[model samples]
Target chain A: MTPRLAWRLLPPLAVAALLVAAWQAWVTLAAVPAYIVPSPRLVAHTLVADRALLAASLGITLGVALQALAVALVVGVLVAIAFAQSRWIEASFYPYAVLLQVTPIVAIAPLVIIWVKDTHVALVLCAAVVALFPVIANTTLGLRSVDPGLRDLFRLNRATRWQTLTRLAIPSALPYFFGGLRVATGLALIGAVVAEFVAGTGGQGAGLAYQILMAGIQLNVPRLFAALVLIAAAGVVLFSCASLLAWLALRHWHESELPPR
Target chain B: MSAAPVLAVDAVGHTFPSGTTALTGVSLAIADGEFVALLGPSGCGKTTLLSLLAGLAAPTAGSIAWWGEPLPPPGRPFGYVFQAPTLMPWARVAANVRLPLELRGSDRATAQRAALAALARVGLAEFADAWPRELSGGMRMRASIARALVASPLLLLLDEPFAALDEFARNRLDDELSHWWRDAGFTAVFVTHSIQEAVFLATRVVVMAARPGRVIADLAIDAPFPRGPAWRASPAFATLCADISRRVAAAAERAA
Candidate 1:
């Protein structure tokens, strides 16, 4: 990497190393029992030893998060377009959208799981519900935020409604929609993990949250620390993926995505 | 000059929805290929009148007719240059210029050629692929002008297009615009608050008074074609500018 990138990566890495060293010293000096708090080295060893099982759980959680995010994007953007076309439609349905947003998905996940026969489908739906609001709100605002002068210019050119929407409104909304997508990606991961916790489903289809629960019940402190590390790493990976996507979509023309000159 | 006028505004009156009377009994007749300048202070309804003439809006009372027919739709018949550049930030300069033709369903190849030619006219052909933000303010305004001209409008309405530019850039654009008008031979109605600009470019200067704006003076400049900086330094130019200045001040005072 370039020196600038190296500079950016250095501070975070240094702080994390210092904190890990301090925790290791405290655990060894105080003779703390591993059952209560595993040393960082023990957690690291468990992560390597239990790689296969942990990797499978991580895959399940990541799959659910990705699927839920896709569903949210497709449905949320379509609903936002409909809202842009009619103030009346937006007024009629926006309150219910807010209601869905306000209600806790964890409370509703049980009912969804009981009603939906497929566990995966139920979990994806739960995650989608938690992630849909920002996409709708931001995309709607973007679609409505067309420059008045540009709108007048289009009108003067006698543009058809379809032409106006495709050429103007959609492109205008792309930046805001991408912003929502970033937020939704993180929320989808959180929702998936939370739903898995609530369902407590296990065996072949178990996600990271299930592994985490099992490790805690067995008092396998090293395994618990390993599961926690995997979840944190997964969250970081999901966020980086979203950021990359936003940068790719908007780097050319968008004000927010432009690099400093 | 032809006896018959191409467009006529007959006793036009307008009161906005907010109960502000913007214009009252404004009347003018524009001859073919004549460069008319609308000179007035702020809030004088010059822009409102331009918008009406461009058919962006209808006058509240009376009528505006084009070639004795009903007012035509805006784009091909009338191109408007707003005070600001007003370019689509997402579009490249060429695409912005090609927009009107695209809206009219022109073939892509033909529209591209025409857009390039228009850009060439404004000396922006080299910057067709550049984004609006990459350009300076004056360059952005040129791109705006190129977009306005791409459709080959019969009448161009400019609403204080150079008012925001520095004095040097403004004067340079004024010269370029005057040259473009001479070559294209299209009817132009330029709205400006600059007294020197009004004197420099117009074939006929229509001085307006504010507070329900109405025409106060209609003076015809008898200067020759292709006026340059030499003409700007002439005694006749100074005399005309002074006369218009006095009338404008008197109109403002009378309104107060």
Candidate 2:
């Protein structure tokens, strides 16, 4: 990174460090009980001690989140393309997409878990449902937002339907699709954890939410905090991956991805 | 210029579905390689007439024929430049220029070469890989013109393509466009609201009035090729401009 970027990032890092120091100091000074609120040191110690267990659970959760994200992206983009192709289809089906969006995933998770039978599959479905809306909404808007003059130019050139869709509609929709991907990644993580909480699935294939639940029930506040941190880190990693994909696809030409000139 | 006309507009008229009469019984005959300027006020249907000539839309009344046939069957026969440079922002200049050829099923290498050649013609060869947002307004317009010319169109239709540019840029582009039209030997129908531009560039100026737009005067400019600053300052140029201006003003007044 450049010196300017390092300098820009320093303030946030410093503030977070200061906040952690204050938390540690307060815990030590107040003689706070571990079951109530663990010190930063205790939480760090617990994180190291429980690394194998937490890491296994994190792998399971991350797997679910990634699978959910993949499904959401593919299904959402296909649905958006369908909507773009026909007004009749869009009018008939768009209401159901909106319905899915407005319905709370927590309320829907129980039904999904019951119907799917397999806990991992249920968790993926729940997360996918939560992540799908942004992709459909943004991609649909982008596909329909082609410049009118460009559309006319295409018509004048006698472009076939396939040509118009592939050349014009798809390229136009890319930035919006990437925007949706960034949003969907975070939502997928949330959805995965929430689905795990609802299912109460545990043991060898248990996700991080199960570890968190077990830690809380046993009053192991330090381990709970450690699991929370891992979940937050996973969310950040997913977001960064999406952003990197977007930048790689659009850095050369797209307005949203262009560097300052 | 010739007895056998390339295209004929026989009392063509257009009425929008909104009940607005954009053009009414307008007629003109364009010969091969003639640069005809359609000069009129806003809402005078000059653009509508150009669209008709390009076969972008059919005339609601009367007929427009290309080479005495029905608009010469829809393929890449003509190029049109709009008032704004309507380039796809996602594509590089070369890709944008190659769009017409790509749509018509040209191989990638052939289209790329043709696109580069077109860009070179418009002096944008070096910037072929540059994005549209990276180009200046005048450069973007040049790229747009390059895109239009990539197919080596027989008839070029321009609807006030340089109206958004500054005076110096407009003048320079006008000169360049005239030269390109001359070298390519293509029939051009230019639509503009600028009297000076019409006077400077056209072989003949067709003046129209608003409110059911129709031609009021068709004046032949007998000036020779390669018109310059000297021609713009010439007595003949002044006389022709004044005469056309007077007629346009009179038409506007009569409409009002």
Candidate 3:
């Protein structure tokens, strides 16, 4: 990596190391029971020892989040475009969209699980619902935020509605859309975990949330800590993926992505 | 002046929904190949008039004819340069210049060629790949002009396109615009609050008054083609400027 990138990575890694060291020192000095607060070494040991079970669970949770995010991106953007096509349509549906967002996922997840027999699909649907609003809201604002002069230029050229949206509005909406996507990705992960907890599916295809739930009941604190660690890691990785995509798509002209002049 | 005018605005009037009158009894017939400047102070409805001429809005009273047809929804293939450069920040200069043709359903290759040619005309061919932010303010304005000229428009409308630039950049653009008009022989209606810019570029200056803008004086420059720095430094230029300045001051008095 370049020196600039090295600088960025080093500071975060150093802080993490310091936190781990502090945690271990406290655990050793206080002689705390591992069930109450596992030492950093014990958590690391449990992470390796339970790798197979934890890895499978991690795969399921992350898979659900990713699928939900993908579904949300497609549906949300199309909905936002439809909103742009007519103010009447936007006025009618926008409030319900806000309602979907404002209602907590846990409140609705149980109802969704009961209604949809296929638990996995229901989980994905629940996660997608939570992730959908930002893309729609941000993209709608971006579509409306067109420069007035540019709008006139399009009108002057007699651009068709399709031409205006694809050539002008879509490109204009991208930075804002990516911004929404970043937020949506994190929400998708949180929603996925929440839905899995509510679903309580435990047999062969149990997710990390199920593992975390079981570990807490069994009081296998290190295993619970391991599952929590995997979730945190997954959230960071997913968030970074979104950031990288935003930078790649927008580095050419977007102010947020552009190098300083 | 030509026997048949390109644009005829006959006793046009406009009132916003809020009941502010923007234009009143505004009649103008712009002949083919004439560079007309709409000179007035702020709130004089110069922009509203231009928007109307372009069929961006319909007048509340009266009518307009473009190339002998009743105003708009019939394609006249005109270009408009807004007060701001208004290039799409996301697009390269070439793509931005090609926008009109692309909107007209021209094939990509043809539009790209026309874009490059237009950029060459505006001395921006080399900068066609640059983003709008990569360009200086004057260069960005040049790209805006190239976009306007790319499709070989019949009429060009400018709304104080250079007003934001420094004096040097503004004068340079004015110089290039004058040359482009001379060589291409297209109809142009330029809107500006600057008396000097109006005097320097327009074949005829249509001085307008505020408190519901109406034409105050229409004076033809009667100067030869391709006026340059020599013309600008001459006593003739100063005389014309002084005359136009007096009319503009009278407009400010009326508005007050």
Candidate 4:
């Protein structure tokens, strides 16, 4: 990495280290019960011991989240494009999309589970619904919000609607699409966990949610902390990956991704 | 000389939906290779008339034709440079300049070569990879002009393209644009409020009246090509500027 990037990465890395140190020290100094908040070292040990189970559960959860994200991206972009092209379609469906967004995922996940029957299907559906709004909203806004002068220039050049969208609107919407994806990445993970929590399933019992619950019920605090750590790590990894992708795509051109002086 | 006029605006008029009349009975005929400046006060519909010629907006009355053909769909007939440099912020200078060619379905290599040549024409060949934000205002305008000229347009329409620049930058661009116009030999219809700019760059300056714009006078500059600062200090230059300024003041007064 360049010195500029290394300098930027340093502060966040330091903060994370500080947080881990604080957690370890607090657990030891306060004589806190492991069942309440396991020491960072104990959590690390538990994670190593339960690697097979933890890895399996993490794989399942990641799979579900990724599938949901893919669905959200495809459907959300199609919907956004529809809204961009037709005022009538936008008027009819945009409010319904807003309704979907405002409706609580936890409240609706159980109903989706009941309706879908299959646990994986239910999880994917719930996650997709939860993540759909941002992509649609951001992409649509980007499509419609082109500079008027550029629009005129394009029009004067005899650019067709498809030409405008592919050459201009879609490229313009890229930052916004990635903005939505960053938000949706976390939401997809949350949706998978929430759906698994609501709809208990057996036979390779789906994802980290089941493992977390089992750890809690068995009074295995270190294991519970390990599972929680995995979830948090997954979220951080997703966020960092999404942010990196955005930076890579926009770094050369967009102001948002410009390296510091 | 026997060819049809490159662009003809036949008694065109327009009014906004809010009931504000922008133009009334504005007629102009531009031959191929002609450079015309529409000089007027702000809100005099000079830009609006250019928009009509560009086919961005339909005239409320009468019509505009290109080379005896009715204006092709709003975007196909001419290239336009707005007052602001409307380079896409997310695109590289090369990508921004290549937009018109891309829209026209040219292959990437062909587009890249044309875009590079156009950038070289505007002295921005070195900055092709830079983003719009990285460039100075004059550089951005150069990119905009490069984009306009890349398609080898039949007609180039500009709306006060240099009005925002400082005197030094503006005058330099004026010289560059005049050179480009002379060599490229495209019909140019430039709209500017500056009497100096009108006289310096145009073969003919069409003075416009304000508030429902109408052409008040059409004065031929009859100056030689590659007009420099020395030309600006010449007696003929002063006479034309003074005459146009007087006409503009009279038009503004009539509107008031």
Clash number for each model = 0, 0, 0, 5
* lDDT by residue (tens digit), candidate 1, B186-209: 899999999899889999999988
lDDT for each residue of candidate 2 in A1-261, tens digit (9 for 90 to 100): 998669857997899899999999999999999988899898889889999999999999999999999999999999999999999999999999999999999999999998997889999999999999999999999899898788878988988999999989998889999999999999999999999999988998899999999999998888999999999989988998999899899987787877677
* lDDT per residue as tens, model 1, A101-147: 99999789999999999999999999999899998999999999888
Model no. 1, DockQ: 0.68
Identify the leading candidate in terms of TM-score: 3
Q: Largest DockQ belongs to which candidate?
A: 3
Residue B222, model 4, lDDT: 96
Full-model lDDT for every candidate: 0.90, 0.91, 0.92, 0.88
| Candidates arranged by lDDT, highest first | 3, 2, 1, 4
Give the range where candidate 3 chain A is weakest over 10 consecutive residues by summed lDDT: A252-261
Give the TM-scores of the predictions, in the order they appear: 0.94, 0.95, 0.98, 0.94
Candidate 4's C-alpha runs over 4 A off are: B1-3, B73-77
- What DockQ does each candidate score versus the true complex, computed on alpha carbons? 0.68, 0.70, 0.89, 0.73
The model with the greater TM-score, 1 or 2, is: 2
Comparing only chain B with the true structure, the TM-scores of all models are 0.96, 0.96, 0.96, 0.96
**Per-residue lDDT over B1-256 for candidate 4, one digit per residue giving the tens place of the 0 to 100 score:** 4477988889989998999999999888888888999998888889989888877789999888778878563333467899999998878899999988888778989999999999999999999999898999999999999999999887899999998999999999999999999888888999998989999999999999877778999888899977888898899999989888888888788778
Candidate 2, superposed: residue stretches over 4 Å from native: A4-8, B1-4
Candidate 1 is graded, for docking, as medium
Supply candidate 2's per-residue lDDT for A254: 85
